[model samples]
Target: MFYGKYYLLFFISCSPFCLLGQKAVGIGTSNPRVTLEVAGDAITRDGIEIGVIDDMVDADTSTFLVQEDASNKLKTLDVSNPTGTALGYIQEYIIENPNEDWVLNLDTNISATEFVVNTISAYYNRELDIDGYATVPNFSAYIQDGTWRLTADFPSANNLYDNEIGTWTITTLIYSRDLSKQLGTITIPMNNGSEGSHANPIID
Candidate 1:
């Protein structure tokens, strides 16, 4: 009876080690293909740390985490070799005349290499009161000489008795090639003519 009890105790103690060495451990699964596999979602009270090194480094907006297929390792990528889209910068401008070619200056932090002009788009939401009717003007925004420009082809007043006056809210969306980088939006307030009796149809 003493020998039988000792054998039972030894088997119970070595059973876990034998099972670990034989097959992988699985949670919520009958079969596990890896060292440790979870068939369902898992929750980690402490934040997960990736990569081989355990250094404490802060991640920025331009930083991305990726897993390598061959090595099966996690790594961090920056804007230089970004894996996905990144948020860029934004700048705004106010112009008094839409008929004139207005030059836009970029922000100091924005680099030309970060965005392309082809991916930039501009739009405006405003209508002119002409002859007791609403009329929309042709406005355009483009980049030239390494700077953004805005222009408009507004229709002239019907006669000397008529005058055009209002404010236009123009928005520009800028992005990089392959849509990997979004440069941000530009809000422009365009003021046409003046208020009161001094208002004229002249577009300068």
Candidate 2:
């Protein structure tokens, strides 16, 4: 009868590919394996699938940038020590460092939990169109029984067209952390290369 209906149409077209046999190809595949690892050699067995490590969210803690003391007049000192303990002074430190605007006379506002800072002392007057010079000084302090004795002297480049002045005195030895309440500021950096208006001095 037509060779048993051609063997029942080749067993119903192979019975849906033998009922989907021998699967497991790759990543939930239907014979989809572009390379799930299958080297050579007959007897080989290897399986290592490690991928799913997602759990990290913690990073936010970095903020401490202080530098904004452009002078607002808060230099006070009224004295009182030897247990009667007292602190408050800045009398004056006005050179806002505007490239060394020159003019600072702070003789006393003493405060030292410890002391020793004097490396700034200057005097200038030699002109010839100014050629080379530099200066940078900043300091402000106040705390539990304040204390400081710093020094510095710098500023000199007189030659090349007159008006070359200098004066730098930076000394430090400030201390006061017993009761905790510290406040200090200092930053000096001056590089001169003649061009007009180069005067620095007066930090008594």
Candidate 3:
């Protein structure tokens, strides 16, 4: 009775997804639990693979590049890292620094913008605060084909003082198409001029 039951148990174990008692195909592994058990270093010529493989590190251009360093250390340049794709960078900014100011780099190859993001056909420039209000310096820039410009309206309504000779430490954050970086602070000396408008951003 014990021998009979042992054979029955073996038959039942291979009942589902097993083929005619054939040997299973194990990819990158010696012991395969399933019909196609791939333990490591798996690759599909056409299907979508998430990560890169070291086996093809020398000649694989279809996936993220993997190469050896000067110290003979292998390095993998993660494709997921910022290659400066418009939507990729935009999404990263939204996730990492949601409240941070977003700027565009107008000096880069605008062709990418024209191809992916919305087109800036004409001379275009904009500046706004998180509250949707113009900043104290009214931070702004303009870049068209053959021109580059930046302007700010210092001593804005949000920043008005009563001193005859005052200073404004403007913290300027930049987020542009080709660049997203902190440009540090700018010291703008101000003076409530002897007349009307304040000499806020003294361009001298």
Candidate 4:
């Protein structure tokens, strides 16, 4: 008789947990796909603090990551063009490319509906791709005869700062090439290095 009364009290105490076992727990999803499936926007309230320092290392550390140009700017060309249609101008592209394989477009903003012929450089002939043959290529434009050069890359990802310095390097230029003096140098504050800024890399 005493055992039956003790058993009844135990069942009543565990009744709430037994009922919960019949229903699946969900955070944001009404019908969870898995045991712990989470659905919805998630944001951390604080900066991630790592327990170990080894997690910061990566497999590939060569070539700094560059952000693509935010927008295309029109700059007046000092070089004169033989055409009488209009003033000479080129697209001053300022961008960042993570892959480092930047393709120069005549105009990224150019639409099929618009009729515009961008001016080409007298000193060089450019194209959408290297050696693709161009019609008045103005950027990545090769000189009639030029030598490809190499230079140092831009500030590494580890050297990034909060204050963005105005840059003309455009995904900005790094270890860039200087095809007949077309590649300009990137000056960084007091340590400006233009001698080997644009390293002309021949695309294979």
Candidate 5:
């Protein structure tokens, strides 16, 4: 009867685990429809990593993580207009006179409705010369005709005979209105040189 008693003790010890295996486990709810369910927020110390662990080592700022509606699985959602938002730089934009405006044709496929543009960086500086300096130029960007356009305005200056040279570079960022997605970036570089009759001429 000693052997029989030991076997009964063993069965009693294993009974709870066997029942747990077949039933759903609920942390904050009495009734759980899934294998594991939490009624409230759950926190993980190590962080939740989706997709293949090895493949997820690298992180992309342009992509976001979202749960798929059909599969109910987490996946990486890439920016929709990767190629459509690409912008080419202008090799040479000339500004022959002061207070003159130049239109820079941006080579891009960004749509007005899908994304908005903002100037993240705008910088202009005239060449270091004695008694010859130019004020900071104005800049504006917009999307039109299935592309982008940049307008540069050089304020009027009395020093027309002053020989000044420098460069202006503007970096623009394109993203969704909600700011959830980053479409792309554009950098425009303008080389300026003005001497004699020309007010503020851009060579390159």
Candidate 6:
């Protein structure tokens, strides 16, 4: 039995589905059980032929979303690990780093506040949090029309304090070459008044 459902044993021809059998094969899961039988040139309603089924699979899995890395490369995520799904992948990046901040190097020039990260897909019940001193902030970035752009800064309210923690996904990582290599480095405009020497990220 597959998922506690019983099927009849027979090879039948149907379109869009390929299962035609009433035999109970042991597949112990709560998920619905289905039986598929294919004879050359015959298909069924529950399952299609191997080649047709393969084509129906989506390239992106439901477990994770895709985001562009700092280098503009795509990365897969495991969204199941987080509490929210509607929140973007950029939110996931920030949640991974609570005590420290992050930065990225986009190959173009841009200001911080003007940056925005676009989601290729929409999720449900997502949220974001960011916490740090005002000097340098953690954020995301993206490339547009061959030029670099600064995305939005993370939301400070949801931040993880000494004992409290929050989460977010990062669609992009915009950092300077120097900060990219350092764990806790954050970027501040030359005129901003905050001052602090760089420190390695604290991992506990």
- TM-score of candidate 1 relative to the true fold: 0.32
The total number of steric clashes, by the backbone 3 Å criterion, in model 1 comes to 0
Q: After superposition on all CA atoms, what RMSD does each candidate show versus the true structure?
A: 17.0, 24.2, 19.2, 21.5, 15.5, 19.9
Model 2 regions more than 4 Å off = 1-88, 93-111, 114-130, 133-147, 155-175, 181-204
Q: Pick the candidate with the highest lDDT.
A: 5
lDDT of 1 by residue, 19-123 (tens): 678578999988899777898756677887765745555663345666657975655656545454444333343444333322233322323455643323333
* Stronger candidate by lDDT (3 vs 5): 5
Which lDDT values do the candidates have, in the order given? 0.50, 0.39, 0.39, 0.36, 0.56, 0.39
Q: Write the per-residue lDDT of candidate 3 for residues 82-189, one digit (tens) a residue.
A: 562222222111111111222233333334333223222121122323344454433443565644433333322322222222222222223344332334456544
Error of 6 at 126 (Å): 11
TM-score of model 3 (CA atoms): 0.23
> Candidate 3: minimum summed lDDT over ten consecutive residues — where?
91-100
lDDT for model 2, please: 0.39
Ranking by TM-score: 5, 1, 3, 2, 4, 6
Backbone clashes under 3 angstroms, per model: 0, 55, 7, 21, 1, 30
Error of 2 at 110 (Å): 3.9
In candidate 4, clashing pairs total 21
Candidate 5 error regions (>4 Å): 1-63, 67-73, 77-107, 125-136, 157-166, 177-204
Error of 5 at 148 (Å): 2.6
Cα TM-score per model: 0.32, 0.20, 0.23, 0.19, 0.37, 0.18
Could you tell me the lDDT of residue 113 within candidate 1?
A: 57
lDDT of 6 by residue, 30-136 (tens): 33345532322332459534553443365644554344567544344454456643323342233333332222343335333344343332111223343443433
Segments in model 1 whose C-alpha atoms lie over 4 Å from true places: 1-113, 117-135, 157-166, 178-204
Q: Where is model 1 poorest over a 10-residue stretch in terms of lDDT?
A: 99-108
**Residue 132 of model 5: what lDDT?**
53
